[model samples]
Target: MYSGIGDHGERAAFLDARALIGCRHRLLLDSTHPRVLTGVSEDAGVQQRREAAAAHRMLVRDTLVAADPERWLVIAPEQTAAQRAAETMAAMEAGIERIWGGLLPQELDTGRRGGCEILRRDPDRGGYVPIIVVNHKVTDPRQPDPADFHPLTTELYTWNPKPDKHVRNRPQPRDQQRLAHLYRMLQRHGYASPALVGGAIGYHFDRVLLHDLGPILDDYDRRYADRIAVVRGELPTVPSKVPECRQCPWWSRAPEEGGQSCEQWLVGRRDISLVAPGSRAEVLRRHGVETIDDLAAWEGDDPDDWQYEPFTEAIVTARAWATGAPLVRRVDRVQVTRADVEVDVDLESYQEHGAYLWGTLLDGVYRGFVTWDPLPTRDEGRSFAEFWSWLMEIRAQAAADGKTFAAYCYSRTAEDKWLYESARRFAGMPGIPTEREIQRFVDSPQWVDMFQAVSEQFICPNGKGLKKIAPVAGFSWRDPEAGGEASMSWYRLAVAYEGGEPDLSQRTRILEYNEDDVLATQVLRDWMTDRADAEVPAISDFGRRSIAE
Candidate 1:
């Protein structure tokens, strides 16, 4: 029925719960997948506990039953992994301390297990005939194979709870081919249209699917030996860290933090993926270079090879890491014009979309972020116009005062990319910065990218990310994890501005994060200016200001 899992930190043979729920490809791929970060997040951890608690209350009692032999089974005789996980937690507010499920090999081999949480059986007979798989994820769970059920069963249904406004129901992907393969079709039914989870409770009846159980039984048998070996700690997994590891639960808990920062380890990882999709980072790894150092060390040995360009790029990346500076190969003294009047900008946005708010620091005075009431998905509303007009007016005044206008930001990639995107998106909006104007503003000498400036001079560990480097620049954040990602989460928690009324608490946090970002640049700028000491390059490409001509 299933593999066995012993109690807390106990070693015993067990099958992973996912192997039962996953498609065949996902099963095989995940089995061999590295332990590094793969799509795990703190928010997701919170949501799972919330959903599991809600689901636990929904399915635990004498729930429902129907005689259709396809849909309803109120009470299940077996406890599922989801239930056990929920029970083991101190409370939903408290985190899921750990994941616990599956049976010992003897009980597991009894042919009654899966990722599903509940198991129901026919009244006249015994054993599990239908499984109600409870998934806490917002998306609907995929349908299971008929063979995974007991020979005595006759039906199965996926029971999931989600946060949809109920405009659409989650369940009812009949998937007849998968259902047909089960070979117990009283009829082919997809139930494709989802009505509502709330409506489902009214129709529960007692019936079960006793489909072909042979394949799953064989699957269990095939996996038993390997399962035992894993329990015995005979298998060691080397993690290949990906971008997802930045927020992964496992990475947070793992003893070793081996990641991109480790050049030697990073360059050697190459894992092919299919069912478990790989980020395919191996394209760079395939070039026979692993770390940034390796790339930097290439002395034009393979001039004719295709890896040259990537190698060249890697040298810059490695040197930047080594020195925390940008443009390592360039010997030019990195300098930008200093003036009495300075403008520093930071934008906050939903990463899935364009900027919602743009904040600026003016002459060391915080001017505040500009955003419209009821944030638009892509429109450059009045607030953007207001912000731009003021910026232009300031630029004019600074020029009139015989002082250069040095506009600043920490990183160009996000702030630079977003401003142009917003400009292009709102090109048709009257009084808004046109796409051309946005480009002109970006190219102007006023726009100084501190990130690029620092990278040219410093090699830093933990990468040259602003949060890490900001402290060195004598800047600090009041919030624990103030980042672009954190701000997005804050945006969700923050109330939207309504009819000129702002949500102060949410607005405050957003502003705080933005201010810290802008100030980090200020610190960096002051440092670079002070460091210039005897010589400052008369001209800098920080922003060419060809537009000023």
Candidate 2:
């Protein structure tokens, strides 16, 4: 059988024995194995167990080799195979221990570096063989105490019965006799004995034999039984005035004797007000305030207010003092309106491979755009330098007009930053605008009108995100269809490329996709403006308010 041991040295020995002499029959021992102490202390003890298991495995192989040079043995260290060996050994050890306690001797050194002895005979000769003693060092040396082991049998049964009740309730004479006979047999055999005598007879026997038996076994006299004891008591009975009796804890108290009137004795105690606000005597007060009638009559919001209302602790305490309970108040709902604006942006590459992205603001009544590309090529001559100067002039004009520069996604802006930084470092040129200036340009209030218009009209059911709601807002694209036609977005196109045939070049496809997106944004803005005019009356109201304010 395959045995998993932590002792690598012992494992090597086992392998050597199998290789040198063909000994197929083997008794795999993993006495101080790490697996045996699963969930044990993680310090030195666990490490020690692992090392010991490995060492023992190798030692077994060596012992086998020394005992029989001609015998051949094979040991597999695979997890599943090793686990099977461990399980078999565990079951056998459990059976032996349960029946015969300390009769089996345990290994002296149970730590990681400890050794264990294994006995096995040769298959061909069938005679006494040399015992294999294997030692494997622990990787970690600390071990835990035995008391930490979790118990197996608790909360097994309920409703233990008394002996007198058991005798009175047994419907069948034969069953009662059988139980008595079993009890007598248990008295003869020791309770620790694994002979199955106590389990065979007694109340358990009745449960096995009779399917209809209710709490007879559970209610039987448990004190005299050899097994665990149980407690049994009668179920409580309800009185005629059930509701009143259920609420009264003293319902089980003894009744007062006649002639000596209980009325006299209960007079001062009858009105023992348990409802006092704060005192030891509060629980004994019994002022009549059961229904809401008493509460409404009392002054202040405390008595009239509902106790379950959600209020501040201070409010609750004040209410309780004033009226002895919580007070409820009406809650108002706050309305918030949200809006979004999608701006069409263009990115122009002045140098062959260098580019700068820009944003075009589309307000309901105005169309203003900003361009900010700088010349990266030093050899491009005066035309490129002039173009760069013109772009910077346009940016200054936009800033003067209160317009903000914004990117479709922050990652796009980050890419621009990286490119700018690299050019400054490699080409010995100054970095474009500082990040603070870029942020200021992106967050200007000049685009507020456009933002409000788009937010109220173009945004989907949810407030944020454009990936899922882009098309729904009338921004159409040529997304690929099932068979293999060109689609609008990269997502749909990628799916088509994967599932169907792809004929277009990657660079061309990307350029086309980006252009389509830019155009869609332009169209979507126009459509959203039209929709606001036709559908949302609140848009005009908001605009008028903004102008007036």
- Among these predicted structures, which one has the highest lDDT? 1
User: Model 1: residues >4 Å from true position, as ranges?
Assistant: 1-41, 44-237, 255-332, 352-354, 377-380, 416-430, 455-461, 496-503, 532-549
- For candidate 2, the per-residue lDDT at 328 reads 17
* Alpha-carbon local distance difference test for all models: 0.46, 0.29
Writing each residue's lDDT as its tens digit, candidate 2 over 43-106 gives 3323443454455446545544565544332323343534544542343333321110011111
C-alpha displacement of 321 in model 2, angstroms? 48
Off by over 4 Å in 2: 1-343, 346-393, 397-431, 446-459, 462-464, 467-470, 481-504, 536-549
> For all the candidates, what are their Cα RMSDs to the real structure?
14.6, 29.9
* Residue 169 local lDDT, model 2: 24
Angstrom error at residue 528, model 1: 1.8
